[model samples]
Each structure stands twice: as C-alpha cells, then as structure tokens.
Target: MSDTSGALVLFSGGQDSTVCLAWALSRFEHVETVGFDYGQKHAVELRARDEVRRNITARFPQWADRLGEDHMLEMRGFGAVAQSALTADRAIEMTEKGLPSTFVPGRNLVFFVYAAALADRRGLKTMIGGMCETDFSGYPDCRRDTLDAVQTALNLGMEQDFIIETPLMRLTKAETWGLAKSLGGEDLVDLVVRDSHTCYQGDREHFHDWGYGCETCPACELRAKGWNEWVAEGRPTLAA
Candidate 1:
C-alpha cells in the first residue's frame, strides 16, 4: 500500500477476486474494480460482480470509500478465437497440456493489458488480480512466471512503472476463505460465500457453505475441497 497512488482490482465477481477486492480495500488508500464481459456462457457473472460490490459497499462503508470507480467492459472478441467451454457451447474436457476446456487462451493477458491502460490513465500504479497457482485449473496464465512476463511486457509497452499485485497467487481456495476472514472476520467470509460467483455454469440458485456453484464444475470442486479441508483443519485463520 505504501509508495503507491491507488490500486485497481481486476475483479471477476468470483471467490478469488472478491477476496482480492477486500484485500485491496484494507491496504490501499483508494481502490477500483474492473470486470470483463468476454462472452462467457455464464452471463450471470456480470450481474454478480455488481451485486457483490453493492453488498460490500453496504456492509463495509469505510472499506467502500476506498473502493472507488468500477468498469465492466464488453470483450466479446475473446470468444471469437478461443475454443473454451467458458465462451463456447461445449462440455468441459481435459487436454494433453493438463488444462481444461475452460482455459481461454490469452484471456488473462488481455485483461492485464486493459487493466494497465486503465491504471495508467487514472494514475494508479498498482493493479491487483486474483490469480492463484494453487487450487487453480491447469491454466498456464495463472502461473507466477506467466504473470511476471505479462507484467514486464505491460510496463515496457506502457513505459510506466506498474505494480501488478496478486494477493492470492500462492493461496489455496480455503486459504482465500481464510484471507477474507482475516481481512474483515467471519462476516466478510460469509459475505463472500453468499455473494461471490465462482460457478462456471452460472448456477447461483444452489448455495453451499463454500459458495454458490454447480458443485460439479472444476471451480466448484476445487473450492469445495479446499473449504472442507480448511474447516476440518480447525478453520485456521490466516494473516492478512
């Protein structure tokens, strides 16, 4: 938070991004969120993003003040080329590379580039995103090395000093749940469970202790497993 102007969060209204948003509010003087509409089949994510933001604002006014402007840019062009279940009408499948069908090529890269542009224009030197290598699908872009390369490329391209923050880069899904608790306690974690959208299927109707999801998609399975393990491990609190 120190030596920074402000922070912009690349929010997806999902479990990880929600935690990142709360994390930013706790540490930064000013924070903003930006989401993408990349023609994903789960369109509810767009509405969920705004809903989660509103809930956070109403519940934590002080933190909400630090949470500044938000953007939900339309990015259907990503679906045009990527053959992923996220943007295509197909069942999730595994690949030889160990990545699932949900893996959207260049999605994270595109997001970072757009986020960098927004941050540069707003004089925000820090950009936060919720990409974790742990407890994540086999998406290569979620790796630390990939993010580092993207950050380097973005800074060199923009000719601006930008700090790309990944608060949950190494954290598990359960650890992320613990992070929410550490940031704002049980209420915050509960809010995340109730408000965040992590389902690849956009199934918000069904709810669970971990979160609302289809419970069958890769994201839901991972989240459920991590949360169950964390709870079994006495629900240990993590440092913010």
Candidate 2:
C-alpha cells in the first residue's frame, strides 16, 4: 500500500493531463486516474486513453500497483446532452466568434462534480486537471476564474474539503511542453504526441508538425504556432 496522501486526476489522455499524471506520480503517495467516455465522435480518443493507461502503467508499474487499474468512468448518457461539435453530430468549425462549436457546455463542471464525489469517498483531497487559459482560445470552462468558481461550488455542494489543482492553468502550451520534457525527459514529448488525443476530429493516423494537432483547426493552429516558436528558439523536437 502507498502512503495516505492520495490525489485523483481527471485524466483525458492528452498532453496536459499526461504531464499532470506524471507530476502526480512524483508528488502523491497514491494517485488515481478518472477518464470519461463522453461519446465523442472519435472513438479513437478512447482507444488512445487505453494506450495512455498502458504506457503509464508500464512506466510506473509501482504506482499502478498501488493505484490499481486506471478507472475510466463512463458517462455515455451525459454525452447525449452535449450538443457541441466536439462530441456531437455538428461539424467542428474554426471561428473567432464567442466560443467555438467544439466547446462542450459545462464539460468541466460535469467532470469535477463527479470527481469531487469520487475524491470525497476515497478520502482524496486533491483533484488535479490540465485545463489551461493561456493558450486556450475560447473555452469558458478552461478559464482560471471559471475553475475557481466551480471549485467553490463543488465544495459547497459536496460539503467536503477538496482542492481543484490546475498546474497547467497559467502555463502556455509551449511552457507546458517544456515542463513535461523537464519532468519525464525529452522523450516524453514524443510519447505525448503519439499517444495523446487532442484532435477535435479524432484523426490519429497522421502526424503533423505539431504531433496530432490538426493543421487546419484552431487548436492545431495554436499548437503549431507554439511548437514552431519553441523550435525557432532551438528547442529539441520530440521524434516519433
């Protein structure tokens, strides 16, 4: 058995959450992961999640031993109500409008509500996520202020003391890449690009200059811009 100070991470099998997972392994005595099955169009994302669990377990089997198998909590029904292009029938369009069609309404809210319950039951006071505002274009839930409000609401509704920790909230995507490289060696970036899921369309068969980032989409554009800047600064690029 590991130590008692446990943490529950809302893992999405993406670059940011993978970094958080590695960070959690180093900090907590016991670290557990919770992933969602939100019925996103790309079933490949779920497959990617499985791959991420396998890789994490292989890398840190001791942590796996202590934490048990990765818990992929199912919320398939909830996804039916998610009308956003990211998880629904609508086409994902790039826009400078208020929010993108990919923005799933109340996604973070739903994730943390369930995470709070799980954490409270397991005596885990810390709940970590990978939501970032710096590079995020228009996701309301990814904002720092939105997270703070949700944190307060979760504590009030649950009547339990819990901390929603967002280590990547303030860091730009480039900075996040740097942090992951620092923590898990430079090779970790390659692991993220190959294994992690970030595409709104859920395309995984191709690799762009910025890993799986779809070159045409806004997310891909931002990620590509950041990676180009990082490389222009003579940073190392993780190979596939």
Candidate 3:
C-alpha cells in the first residue's frame, strides 16, 4: 500500500489546483487532498471539486489506489473577517492599500497553517499548492517568497519538517495548461476544460472553450489567455 507520506494538495477546485491535484497524484505514491470553504463568492467550485475528485478516481486507473481520503474545512467566519471580492460582494478592483479586491488578507497563510495541521494528523510530509507568481494578481501570499517563509514558520512552530511544494510557482498560466497535458495527456486537459471552475463571479451560465465562466473576470481572462497562447503554440510541450 502507498503511504500517506506522499503529499497533500491544497485543492480549491480551480484550474490551477485541479492541475496540482493531478500533479500530486502522478508523482506521489499516496496523495490526499484538502479544500477550504471561506464563504467564497464562487462556491460552485466546491461542487466542481467533488466532480473532479470523482472523475480522477474513475478515469485514471493508475491513480485510483494512489488517491486517498479527502478533507474539507469550513471557515465561513474567515470570509466574514477577511472580506474581499472573493469572499464578499465587492467589485474586483484595487484597494487604496494597492492590493486587488480579491486579496483575502492572510487567506493563504491561514490555508498553510490549517493544511499543515491536517497534514501532521494525516502523517503527510509534503503539501502541494498551485500558488503562482506569474499570471496572477498581486496577491502577496501566492508569491514564492511568502510560501517559503510560511514553510519555515510551520516547521519552526510545529517542530516537524514539512515540505510545501508549489509546482506551478514559476509556471505561467499557459505553461500550466501544458503541464496538465504533460502530466495526464489530452484527456486530462479535456477534463480540466470541461470540469474545472475559475470564474470569480461564480457565473457558470456562460461557457467558453476554456470552461464555464463570465469570460471577462480576472480569473476567466487568465484562463482564456493561457488557452489561446497554448493553441497558438500548436499546443506543444510547455516546460516548467
């Protein structure tokens, strides 16, 4: 049997997290997943998370046994405290603080803390996240430096060595698509396009080749741009 020492992915049911989930499943012997519900405006992604999980288990024979139990944490109060465009009904723009309205203060930090707590309990040593610097809003938590710092803190505080893996930390959105293809092939790519959710507005009514979304929000824009770039490049291999 594969051990829980493999990895735990911080899956948010978005394109990036879904790809990260697949990445973990491909590389790890036993991969578990964790998702958070901070009252996100686009709560539909939570549903998508379940769909994606079921599809991965059913479609990927090689990964069927490697996948393990899933975990969900409810922190709706966090959304109430850290109000942002993502957790609250506010316009997606820049605050005078120079951060995007989607910036849920300390959201990612809390995620690592919570995920690490769970990982410790689950006997997992590695945690994977889709946090990226490229093709992202200026969310400080998603940056590489922030994640590195958090990892150090988690180790120091917990007195246990835990590795936080950000597979898409440096990869652009377009490269992420290529990564999904590389890890799981065209079928995975198709699954991502059809099942993954990324619209910040939570609009699933509007469907685009990239997926269901408002098609104009920041999240949709990024996903569409990546798809367009991939298509233009003949959809060849994209390096990390």
Candidate 4:
C-alpha cells in the first residue's frame, strides 16, 4: 500500500485549486483538502468545492482511499477587512494600482497561515496552494515572493518545517489547463471546466469552452485568453 500520508491542499474549488488538488493527489499517498468561509461575495465556490470533490472521487476512485475528507474553516471577519469584489456586492473593477476588485487584502496570507496550523496539528509537513501570478488579475499575494516570505514566516512562527507548495505559481492559465489535462487527462479537464468556479461574480449561467463564469469578469477573461492562447499554440505541452 502507498504510505497514505503526505500533504494538505488549500483548495478553493476553483480552476487553479482543482488543478493543484489533482497535482497533490498524483504525488502524495494521502491528501486532504481545506477551504475557507472568508465571507467572500462568491460563496458559491464553496458549494462548487463539494461538487468538485464528489466528481474527483467518483472519477478517480483509485485515489478515493487516500483522499481524506474536506476541511472547511470559518473566517468570520475576513470580509470586513478584505474589502473587495470577492467580499462586496459591487461591480467587478480594477483598482488604481491595476489590481482587480477581487484582490482581497492578505487573503492568501491568512489562508496559508491557517493551512499551516492545520498541517501542524495533523502532523502533516506539506501544504499546497494554487495561487498563480501568470494570467492572474494582479493580486500581490499571488506572487512568488509573497509565498516565499509566507513560508519563511510560517516556519519561524510555528517552529515547524512546513513546506508550502505552489504548483501553479509559474504556469500561465493556459498552461494550467494543459497541466491538468496532462496530469489526469480528460477527467481532470472535465472536472475543471464543469465543476470549478473562477467567476468574480460567481456567475454560473455563462458556460464556455474554457469554463463557466460571467465571461466578462477578470477571472473569465483571463481564462478565456489562456484558452485561446493555448489553442493558438496548437495546445502544446505546457511546462508545469
């Protein structure tokens, strides 16, 4: 039997996180998924997470035994401080600094910290997140430097050797799609397109080949652009 122990993924039931989840499952003998109720405007992604989990387990039963239960955390005050389209009911727009309205302040920081806490308690040493700088909406926390700093801080503060992994950190959105297809083939791609939610507005009605969303929001635009670019390049093998 596989060692059946490895890492936890900071899963958001979005395209990137779902791909990260698949990546973690491929490498780890055991994997647990964590989501946060951070008072985001698009809480629908939480529901989508459940559905995506079911789809993954059903389609990839070989991983069922090692795939642990989902962990949902309540961050009651996140919306009060984050103050973005993800937490507010306003039109999705960009900030003066070129960041999209969905850029929640220190959101990824809190997420990584809490995920580290969970890992410490569970004796897990690795935690994976899906934050990407390429093809992103200009969120500062999604950058590689931020993640690196957070990793260092997490170790110093908790006195634990936790290895935070960002599998999608460098991959473009199109490359992410390609990586998913490469890792798990059609099943993974299907789950991402049909189940993952990346819309700033949580618009589920507008379905596209890339995925479903408002199709005009920053998230959808980025996804669509990536898909187009991928196609233009003959859908070449995207580097991880």
Candidate 5:
C-alpha cells in the first residue's frame, strides 16, 4: 500500500463497484468515490450508493481521516440518449446479443473524464473501476482494450498523468466474488449481494437461489450463476 498513491473509484453502488470500493480502500491512502447518474432505469441504485457510503462511513470512521476533502462526488445531467435499452422507453429484452439496452453510450468515457479532472485537481494519479471483461454482457466499455484506449486518451486529453486501474477486468463474477471476500471481509461481499442493485428493471426485492438478483434479467441470471457456482464449490459463500 503506497501512502502517496491516491485513488478515485468510479462507484455505482452495484456489486462490482462495491467490491472495487473495498479494494481501493485497502491500497490507496486517499480513496474517494465518484458516482454518475445518467438517468438509468434503476435510479434507485443512486440511493443505494448513498446508503452504502453511509454504511461504510459508519463502519470505518478512520476513512474520514483518510479522505481530506471531496471525499464523495456525485454527478448528474448529460443523460444518455435512448440509443440502448437501458434508458429506452420500451423494455429491453435481456440477452447477450450485440449490446444490452442498458448500455449507456459513452458512459465510461463520461465517468473517466470527470474522474480524471478530479484526480488532476487532487494531485492523484490513479482512477479505479470494476469493469470486468469476463462477465461483461456485450458492453464495449467493459473490455480491456477499451480501457487501454481510454487511459491513453485521458492522459493525452488532460495532459495529466493518470492510470486507470481495473482490478477485476479479467476476472469472472465468481472470481470477483473471491477477490471481494479476500480484500474486504466476507460480510462485505454479503452486503454487496443484499444491498447492491444490478437488475435492469430495478427489481430490488426479487431474490432467487442467488440472493437479490432479479432471477429474470440477464444480469440477474449471470449473477445467480456465479453465486451458485461459488456456493457449489463451497468457497465461503455469502451469508443467508
């Protein structure tokens, strides 16, 4: 853990970002959270982000000491057009085809743009995210190549030294579960399952054999599959 390295996490109050948040907390001396509200279907997830931040602050009072100022930043406006199913007026059929309707155009680009500006202001060099290629439905932004390109662009555009870190980029959802369990406590991962929102339709209470995933949407199916595999392997599954 480098005491000089400051990290800004692109958090979304979902399972992936929650795990990434915990990971950033362990490595960076200064860990800050930046969330975006692009008018997604699950607007409640933004509320969940605030709840998770409150829970984190309550559990780790020392975290306040870690973050000097601008600890948590939330940005809204610049809403995504109805290009994808995520914000379209009609419901998106959940599938792995081309790209999901939930795919917000230039979402990562917008997020990193703001994060890089903040990093430059704070004299930070690292921006962390939970974009994973293994479990990505079809979003181009979640790919390793896309991240690499974006990193280069951010540095050149801002003329500031910035490194985008995707710790779970190559890991599967099951593998991400393992990482979260190891980095944060197992309870943190359990909190992710119970509290994080990933449903495309904003279904929070829907639960299956795999926790709170809606059990219907593609995101839920993937999450449920990963959790079931983790449980079947007896790999210290989430608490019930």
Candidate 6:
C-alpha cells in the first residue's frame, strides 16, 4: 500500500525532472530520488543528478531535511536490450517506425518498474515522474495512458498499491519552466538552466538559456522554444 506522506522521484537531472523533484519536495515530508543509467548517450545527466540533488538540498533549506537518500540503478542489461539512438551512438532522427530515433522502446516502462521495485524496498508508496505529453517527442511510453496501465500492472503483479504521480504529464515545456519558478522561484529555474542536461546528442559544449544542450537536437529545440515562449509570455508564474 502507498503512503501519502513520502515519495520517490524519478530524477534524471534534466530540467523537467529537476522541476518534478522540487515539486515533490514542496509537498512531501520525505522525498527520495531514483535515476537509471541505461548506457544513455547523454550520461552527463548521470553526473548532473548528484549535483542537482546537492544543489536542491543546499539552496532549499526547507527541503534539505525532507530530501532523503538518492539511488542510482545500473541497467546495462536494458542498454543492451533496448537499442535506440539514446542507447547507441547513432544519428538523432525520425525512425521509419514514425518515432524519434532516440525513443527507446519501453524505456519509461522499465524505469517505472525498477523505480517501483526500489520504492517497495524503501517503503515509498508514491512515485514522482516528469513524463510530459504536451511537449515531448511523441514517445508512447511518455503518455499518461501508458503510465496508468503500467501502474495498474505493477500493483497487480506486486500486490501493492503504488501511486504514480506525473506532474509534467499535461504541461508544455514553457509551462514546465513556469512550474519550476512556481515551485522554487528563480533559484530553481537558474539551477535547472545551469545544471540540467537534456540533449540527446550529449552536447555540453554549448549552452542555452534553457540549459546545456546541442542547439539542433530535438530536445534542445523543444527546450529553446519553450524558454522563448515563456519569456515572451512575460515569464508568468503558475500555481503548483
């Protein structure tokens, strides 16, 4: 059974997941984080994960005590099995199957499954994910329906009720930036922009207002577009 007071956040050290982390910290008394290292092309995110956690704990004193242990799950097996642009050093493009080349089949499903397993061990009933549908690469696994189904299957198979919370599910990237501001103000937004890594091509040499990424990649383009839109909208803050 899931507890209402604590949560496990699926933190990827990217802008979106970092916002989700702050979101979890704002509401939950106790929050833990879990990240997967599936041999992603952008493994720099792995490094950013620790930095993001440290930054959050340091910058948000209110959440310092609430932030609990961080877990990094190694899934080299997943890397081998779920071959895609992310798991391989391939060109980032649209696949013949109509999905982004970076779309690793079942990646989110596997992530949630493993995250649930870790949560079970840690006695965490709630899971916080940053999966977005409004401004995403059309990954089937990022959809709410898919996550809901996975949640049901997880509960049935594990004989435990786990709540999957996707704060960014219905939000656009611009709205996500607004959310970061809402959750932790300018500090959080700056931290996300400075520390997060979201480029599929794993480019950290160039920097953008949104974050560090390759300007041409789909991920970077989406982030830049969102940042610009949010800026043009007077950078309005939203209620979390």
Question: Which digits, one per residue and each the tens of the lDDT, describe model 1 over residues 2-109?
Answer: 544589999998888998999888888888899998899888877888888999989988887787899888889877687689988888989777778899998999
lDDT of 2 at 158: 83
Candidate 5 vs candidate 6, TM-score winner: 6
Give the residue spans of candidate 2 off by over 4 A: 1-4, 60-67, 94-97, 236-240
Query: How many pairs in model 6 have backbone atoms within 3 A of each other, for residues 3 or more apart or on separate chains, i.e. clashes?
Result: 0
Worst 10 residues of 4 by lDDT: 1-10
**Colliding pairs, model 1:** none
Model 5 ranges with Cα > 4 A deviation: 1-4, 60-64, 67-77, 80-82, 94-97, 236-240
| Candidates' C-alpha lDDT | 0.88, 0.76, 0.90, 0.85, 0.74, 0.90
TM-score of each: 0.97, 0.88, 0.96, 0.94, 0.87, 0.97
46-117: candidate 4 lDDT, tens digit per residue = 999999989888999887777886899999587687788778776677778887777888999999988998
- Model 1: lowest-lDDT 10 consecutive positions: 1-10
lDDT of 3 by residue, 1-240 (tens): 134348999998999999999988888888999999999989999999999999988878899999998999999998899999998779999899998899999999999999999999988999999999988978999999999899999999999789989989888888999999998888899889988898999887888888899987888999999999988888876543
CA displacement after TM-score superposition, residue 164 of candidate 4 (Å) = 0.9
Which of the numbered candidates is closest to the native, going by highest TM-score? Answer: 6
Candidate 2 overall Cα lDDT vs. reference? 0.76
Question: In candidate 5, what are the lDDT values of residues 23-109, reduced to their tens digit?
Answer: 777677877888776677777777778777766666656554554343444444556443556655756654455567667778887
| Model 4 TM | 0.94
Cα lDDT, model 2, residue 210: 66
Instruction: Please report the TM-score between candidate 1 and the true structure.
Output: 0.97
- TM-score, ranked from best to worst: 6, 1, 3, 4, 2, 5
Residue 77, model 2: lDDT of 81
Better of 1 and 5 by lDDT: 1
